[model samples]
Target: MKVIILAAGYGTRLFKDLKNDRNEQFKHLIGVPKPLLPIGERPLISYWVEALKVRDDISDIFVVTNNHYHHKFKEWAQKYPFVTLINDGTSSNEERLGAVSCLQLAIDKFQINDHVLVIGGDTLFYEDFHLHNVIGQFETIVKDNNYANLVLSYPCKDEETRKYGILETDENHKVTALREKPSPTDTASRQACPCFYVLSKDSLTCVQTFLDEKKNAPIEEKDAPGHLLSWLVGRNPVHVYPVSGRFDVGNLESYITCHKYFQQNIRNIPTYLQ
Candidate 1:
């Protein structure tokens, strides 16, 4: 499977938190990209890369980043044998392809025929390595039923649910509905759609549909995996597998909190350069 990471966003909202007047994404965070910013002493994205490296399911890792950071990402990824870096080719979001478009790049680049695992670049995942467990959750629906898309969901705090695309599932754990930052009346559950996704090869065709239908407008948060999943649910099965632990670190609060939380609680993150 190819793992595609969406890292092209300008991170405008994240700018204040990530860079001061002196620092940019390329500047050293104890000597790493700000996304490579360390939690303990190891780079943040390193942990995610390490997790994927151990998974026999992942064959190649593709990270789509802005042009300014392409060299930096290429440099950072050099330590890992399987990682590939693709430049988004410009600094402006208008010039860069959105999350779904990045997947398109990966598909075209690799001539991929198998399923792809796509996740937000800013997230930190700490799930136990159980490929069978992950596959088991969606196998019956995905293979036997031949579903086209799948997403990972987890029970999140009600307050935090407001920040994510909340999912509603039937008793069978099949996603029945998705609400992107739904109002009080719209949401039925606190099960949040995190940024991770397992997409079937057929789903790329759906992405083509999106390109034909929605390409005129600039891509936004609404145009990503959430919209893609919601678009596919009735037409095709979009499975959901619950992961035990993960965190989206986009700003200072989540950055510090997830770092401290994981370091103290989840398994110890290595100190590679310190």
Candidate 2:
């Protein structure tokens, strides 16, 4: 399987907070992309890159970023010859193609025909979350159904359902449906779904199929991968892989928290990069 890291978000919320200066400590971070922001000893996305770089199951790692941060990612990508970067030709959030569109761009540009492992650049799971285990589970799913897909899910608080896309699964753990940012009372399921997924190679073309079918739909409908995941659950066998927890560094506070978590649990960090 190949890997695609979605990092094109404009970081509006974090930029707003950093622009407030916060005693001038955040001045340096004013315009950095969330995925490139410093976390612990390295950039946030670097942790994911380092972990996957060592895996033979992964073929190539592609990072899709907007033109605004293209130069910045170019500088970073210089150190890793194994990674390829795609400039989505969008400089701002309003001009940006949503996450799913960005994925389509990368797939088209690279002509990716293999199974792809999709990861959110600004998202990080707990120290105990292992890609080895995740990939193993995904492989098991594929063994039963080659067209099946796997996504990571972690339990979230009842009141926090509004903050994420929740998953509804059957007794067999197959995703029955997805409610994007549903109200806490909308459903009893609290299986907060993250952006991480292992999409089968045979199902790769379905992304373009979705975009074409929803050609006239509002951008909001095609923005998040959850929309596509929900669409996939209907036609394909989408299963859930439970994770303990994850840190989505969307704001300054969450970024700091993710950094501190890594710092305090240094030993748990993967060392495959060395």
Candidate 3:
């Protein structure tokens, strides 16, 4: 299996917040991508790299970023020899290819025909998010349904439903529907789906099919992975694995919170790193 981390977003919101800060120290963080920003003792993405590096099933790790931060990602990639960084040739957020297109680009560039694990670059799970366990569940589901894909979900408040891709699942945890940022009354399910996913080799072709059909559609419709999963759920079975929550370091406040959490709690949890 190959792992692709979507880091192509320009993080306009985060940068905007940083730019207005009065602290001189924040100046250094004004332009840094969310994935590369400091989180605890290391960069935010390093946690992910360390956790997956030891997995025998994972053959490669790919980080897809924009041309605006391509060089910065390249500098960070040097620390992890196993990681391959791809620039989407997008100089700014406005010119960026959506997350789905970036994923498709990596698939085409590497000719990936295996089961691919896709994750958002700015996201991370808590202590219990073991890669082995996650992959094992995916493999177990595949045994019964070859076309099934696994995604992570966490419960959110009713009012927060509009901020995420709300997933409606069956008693068996199979995704029945996905609503991207729907209003609170749209569904009673508070299961918010994140970017983590496992797509089978058979399902790999669906990316191109989606792109072809949505060619005339705006990038906003394709920007989030939820859009792809929302479409995929219609064609194939997608399962949900529950977690307490994830640390989404999109803005300055979240970054600080994530850093503090890892710093204080990492030792209490079992880690994959040697």
- TM per prediction: 0.85, 0.96, 0.96
Candidate models: Cα lDDT each: 0.68, 0.89, 0.89
Summarize candidate 2's per-residue lDDT along 105-191 as a digit string, tens digits: 999998999889999988988756788888899999999998999999999999999999999999999999999999998999999
- Scored against the true structure, residue 10 in model 1 reaches a CA lDDT of 61
Number of the top candidate by lDDT? 3
Candidate 1 lDDT, 1-274, residue by residue in tens: 6778777666554456556534353234422334666675566777667767776777888887788677777778779867888786776756767777776777777788877777787776554534456555545566766545667777777677667788888887788888887765667688888777777776667766766677676567434667766766767777677766567776666767877876686554442111
Ordering by lDDT: 3, 2, 1
Worst 10 residues of 1 by lDDT: 25-34
**lDDT, candidate 3, at 197:** 95
lDDT of candidate model 3 versus the reference: 0.89
Candidate 3's TM-score:
0.96
- In candidate 2, how many Å is residue 273 off? 11
Worst 10 residues of 3 by lDDT: 265-274
